[model samples]
Target chain A: MKRISCDSSSIIALSSNCLMWVLDKFETEFIIPFYVKKEIIDTPLKGKKYSFEAMKHGLLIGNTLKVKETDPILRDKIIKLSNTLLSHKGKPIEIIQYGEADAIALAIKEDVSTLLVDEKNTRLLIEDLEGLKKVIERRTGRDFEINKTSAQELNKLLKGLKIIRSTELIAVAIKRGFFDWPYPRADIVKNALTALKFSGCAISSKEINETVDILTQTH
Target chain B: MKFALDALNFFKKTDTKLLRNLSDKILIDGFIEKNNELINLSIVVHSLSKICEKDYYKKDGVYWKTFVDKIQANLEEVASDKAQVIILEKIIVELDNHFGRYKNNVLHRSKIRKGSTLYAWGVSLTLASQMVKIPEIELMKQIGRTKIVDEEAQIKTISERLKDAEEIL
Candidate 1:
């Protein structure tokens, strides 16, 4: 089974869409950090009933979706790194939360296959293609090609960790027959991606359209 | 202790006059004493950002919004000072990104998955302060997470608490 660690946003996104039940069907082991679990399960807030219920359902799923505690030393290091991680403008802004820091730490320590997160800042900090472009532009005052050298540098910075969003998960779920409906296959996939977007998946419309195109073609 | 107390009090009332006075005192002290003003400026900007955001949603008034903009303008002017430009620009950019995150109801939708605006703001400030070398405990205390007298209590690690939370499964 593919081992995956998730942040709170992805979990809530999956749960809010009523597609969390398909998590087990995908043959992936979902691991959540303790802080992420508390964000969803322990603390109950108004206007967040869907996330609360999703967390309850996640708990009911048992070992397949385990909640793991991060190693203290690793967590501290990740927190420090995340705090020091500069933005596109090279400012040391602490954008990642404890839960995100813990999730990344657990992934690094345990060697998880992927980390599921939906926050834009964390995503940009990790991959940062646009940010890399901006950096280049700021330094040279001109556009530069994103060649292998720049890509390698970014990969090294991100530590070669595979990051996926809830939108991609939804795409995979649709591919695996989790979103079968009476409507046309294209419509079903489009609607599924749109639903994820509306539920705060942080996917762009262009990405959604591309994912829909690929899924439809594969089908 | 006084600075921490004043900061804590500022969060409660979110008075602009209080913030202005505090920033002025810190700036002057930093200039005369040759101490770093980056941390203090970051804290002030962070607090102002939160207050402006809260008022944006709560009162829907133009007063707080314009006041925050004016403060940013003033900060930009201060940034023109040769020595302070870089750090102050970083702080201003961070503040801009912080507000930009909620642009166009994106954060409004995400609030369902994340916690309320209050919770998000609290966490952001806590982490941002940590980046600036402010103690997390102090920020938490200022945010009313811990009582003033209980400041010496050891905060439990998340992993240690998770050991007990495992029983929830």
Candidate 2:
């Protein structure tokens, strides 16, 4: 079974779409860092409505979703790497939260197949080199010349890691007969993906439409 | 420091009207006592920085840069004391760097702790409301942080709670 580590945003996105239960249908083992669990559980209890819903969904998943603690040394290393990777114009950017750092560290330490996240910024950092450069340019207002060493370092850290969003999970669930709605197959897939988008999956309309088409055709 | 504390107290109350009145008092008194506009600006900046944990500048860097530039230009013309001017310039640079760090971190999608993010946002909203002399509640609603609850839809009868409890039990 593939191992998947999830950040809080993806969990919240899944919860918002009422699709958190679909994780049980997969053979994949889901893990969340201790901090990510705290993010889902504690923050919401403080009156964040969205977080509260996510916590409820988390509880519904129960033991299927493993809450793991990243090795402290590995967690610190990943945090340092994340901060270094995000710096622009030779200045360190302190943006990665403890939960995100812990999630990434756990994935790396445990050799998880994928890290599930729904934040646009994080996705770009891991997947889009050009997009990362554009973000640097926007933030610093300077031409971001990608240095060779930095590129190599980032590639090394992120190599062999797959980053997925909640939309993809929903698509998979649709393919696996997890959703038993009476709607047309195409409509069901489209609506499910679209709901994930509106629920903060950071997926574009075009992507959702394309995914819907692909899922229907594949079926 | 007293000014900063007073500003924070007013911010916590979400009293934009009182903050505006206080700003007027600070400006007048600061100018009369110190003959320095930087002092007045510093009071406001100190309060804003303290409350927002300096997240306000990060959220809107260009606006803050422009604001600091305007103050710097004004200080050059009005203040004859070079030492005071230099000190104010350092403050401006520090504020600029503070916001710059935030902007970079966010762009990189580096995680910021949930609690800090919420606190920063809350403080930023309060400071913006006070700066604009608008009610914080109005700003909160405008920002989609607060919503008009439908009383009828939200009402849960005692029977419903009992039924839920019974089902759980």
Candidate 3:
């Protein structure tokens, strides 16, 4: 079976008003890293208990799926990738480390045709991994690779779903370094959210705006 | 951040109006059913207080103590059940003490820029879900928020209202 594995980065994008469209575009076995589950519990789904109901239906298939632990070899590969990215970027590769990398390694281990990843720089990092490089080169006859799409493509896909408002998509896009820079990107997302009317759901524009403002003003 | 506080204040003022615009039956029955509104309000206040107490900038620019007191006062004034208000106050205090122990030692303004909005939304919605019994912790284990993806199913269930609008208008 041609499997499809996802990093948490993709999962975050998919669950938040983007699921409907992404699923429409890509359908296959989705695997998440065990660390992804830990990270989810640490944040995002922090207080909401409904995640259980969502998980029951296989929103994320990790704990139930039999995944080989990070063998010493894979661990060394990840550590090297981390160090190389850290050396190059001067800051750590934030999202695509730890469990996320494990997910990519697993996908390659499974010989999956497609790996759904969302972070921008993951491709570059994966280029340095020997095992994955061999697979990518053999598969593409050029290089073994981590497949990816940009935040922009994800936003465009969301727009197509009409699940979230275009303005909101643009805002998220801008926030994720989508809009170029300087201007408050969340403003774009807010406008998009307002435009979508968000299914007439009783959304707290006030709270969202406030949080974004706080984020902008302080940071 | 400035905007978030202003927005919160705006929401507080308009909160009653929101409950007001609904039909009298809803206000009297639905909003009051099993003290759902009261529970929701208490949870919101509790979470706000928690945020205020925990935020790093909270001590520098924000008045955590004053803000929390105001929310407490508002709950008392608006609460239909006086006893619940007192009980909720104690719980909030207890929570404050408990959470305070794990306070972040180094919260730099610089790192704030790197925060994830999806993570923020997830945390907020998770708290809201937990209060309503939908629970984000369990949801976190799942790949997505399946049960409440519609959102309308849990928090803002209004299919009946939509049907009413279609029929009457």
The candidate scoring highest on DockQ is 1
- In model 1, the Cα lDDT at residue A40 comes to 62
For residues A94-190, what per-residue lDDT tens digits would candidate 1 score against the true structure? 3456866777778877787477875444454465544534532442233334444434543554575667776677666666677667787788878
Greater TM-score among 1 and 3 belongs to 1
Place model 2 in a CAPRI quality band: incorrect
* TM-score, candidate number 3: 0.33
Please compute DockQ, using alpha carbons, for every candidate against the native two-chain complex: 0.06, 0.04, 0.02
Share of native interface contacts recovered by each model: 0.05, 0.00, 0.00
For model 1, the chain A TM-score is 0.79
Q: In candidate 2, what are the lDDT values of residues A136-162, reduced to their tens digit?
A: 454334453555555577668778667
After superposing candidate 1, which stretches have Cα over 4 Å from the reference? A45-58, A61-64, A87-91, A129-158, B1-169
TM-score per model over all chains = 0.53, 0.56, 0.33
Q: How well does candidate 2 score on lDDT at residue B164?
A: 28
lDDT of 3 by residue, A72-128 (tens): 465346444443322111322122345545665565555553444433223323322
